[model samples]
Target: MRYKGFVIFTLFLFNIITIKPKAIDEKDSLYIDNCKRDLLVLMMAYSDEIRDIEVSEDNYIYLVLNNNKKIIYDDKKEKNKNAKILDADIQDTLEDIYPLDSINSVLEGMDPGRGRSYTFLNSIYGGNQNEIEKNLDFFSTYCGNIMFNKKAKAGEALKNALNEAKELADKDNRVNNYIFPISGSYNYRVIQDTGRLSPHAYGIAIDLNRNDSDYWKWVDKSKGSKRIEEYPKELVKVFENNGFIWGGKWEHFDILHFEYRPEIILKSKFFGDTSKSNNKKWYEGAPLNDEIENIINIINSKL
Candidate 1:
């Protein structure tokens, strides 16, 4: 009986020793997990351009932008005639509110390595790789300090926009279609030893269908000027509803690019398919308007 008691006591001590380290490991893992979630929220709230997010074992997150392939912008395109000049008043307002030095700091900080990135102007204006780099560098220096400080409102707005976009996409039978992920803070990128802050750094940008996209840079220079005619209106509407601006709206035209620049989109009055004044209407009509309404209804019925 004495020997049995001693064995039992020794076994209990061993179990406690083993369980303590396991508990500590579990606690450490949970701490790391929570830290990552907080950082992700911060990044998503800051920029809308990030797509394809991956979290690694080491706690680093990898993100890539859905930048469209570069293509030529044809001057003779019908849309060019309709392209409204960006509001001068808004431009002036932005200039006054976000000075050149501030823009520069944001750009400089975005670069992961060297401080230069390519920026091609409208194809009609003639392509100059060197000139694009210079302009981007200058712009970065000018607007570097314009930090997006409105967190709670921005997050709420973004979530609302995402839900609206998802509903619209479902209605249009494009539910499986890639919706741009817009939320996240901007980060600097260093590629090929050149540094330039991608618009994605702002967390309000998204790109879709990288495989089927056209970009100005991908256009054959020999063609002189050729504009890609395809534009993803359904996708654009989703973005616009969420207060994002499409790259297709720009003369340089990146059809797949969407950025969170509510100030510009709102000023342009390009609300896409989402009505600003009828937000409540949108919410009520969402399930009805989409093809997935039946599925959603069935799920609700079960509940």
Candidate 2:
């Protein structure tokens, strides 16, 4: 695998320099440049094995690998839900962003605008469903039994985080209601209303106590007043600290949903937005080398 990456990267290096940068508004240009650098920096933080990165004339950021495969940094497509991260109104820090205050006062988490990038995530887990399925493992928690991607090593991280949250719930009655029996994880499917793939498809997202949870879709969309009165904020802190982002934070409000997105957490801490990730060391969960290699292979195949 390493040899494949080296060969592909060597062949592609010369090709990238020939592709001129796109012409856009000065402000947009600066944003795109920052996005490009951040995307490369973030990939490197996770694994230094990434061969190369380049911004195209169309503003797509490509992460090139040795096997000649590539993953789009952020497609920035009208249809790409995750591409919204480049333009979403996100906060600077986890605390400030998830602020358990009145929903009306907060706008940062309202629209995660960013949806999960399938190719990018596939790189991290496995490129296809069969590959990803091989990495699936089950864990039992106070909430219930759940399945998740063991390759990402986040499943273990979440189990640990849940232990801490369980301790907190034991001490506080209110916290007990936050996580009832879990709904699910690792379902291979596109989002219900869109062609976009879901984080659940990668086995990184979990939906908690469906009965207690409130989804925006359950209510009238035009009314526009959805208030969260029962989500345990302390429990949320535990998940975020472990690299999970709560759906409760989004304006769409899927109170029971939480997905692993360490990049977003790290981005909030350093740049206050998920736009830039330069110079940050990966100090989050322990990522296995084999898994990282699988991710690289996916990137190369796509490139």
lDDT for model 1: 0.36
* Stretches > 4 Å off in candidate 2: 1-29, 48-60, 65-68, 76-110, 140-145, 220-227, 273-303
TM-score of model 2 relative to the true fold?
0.65
Worst 10 residues of 1 by lDDT: 96-105
The TM-scores of all predictions, comma-separated, are: 0.35, 0.65
Question: Candidate 1: which stretches are off by over 4 Å?
Answer: 1-152, 178-187, 190-195, 220-230, 270-303
lDDT scores of the candidates, listed in order? 0.36, 0.60
RMSD of each candidate relative to the true structure: 22.3, 13.4
Q: Lowest summed lDDT over 10 consecutive residues: which window, candidate 2?
A: 86-95
Q: Candidate 1 residues 1-303, lDDT tens each?
A: 999999999999999999989999967654343333322322233233323344445534333333432321111222221121221111121111111110101121111111111221121111243322222211111112222213223334445555666566667644334443322233333212224336444333445444233343554422212222333355556556565555544333444555554443332331223322432322232324343344234323322
- Among these predictions, the greatest TM-score belongs to 2
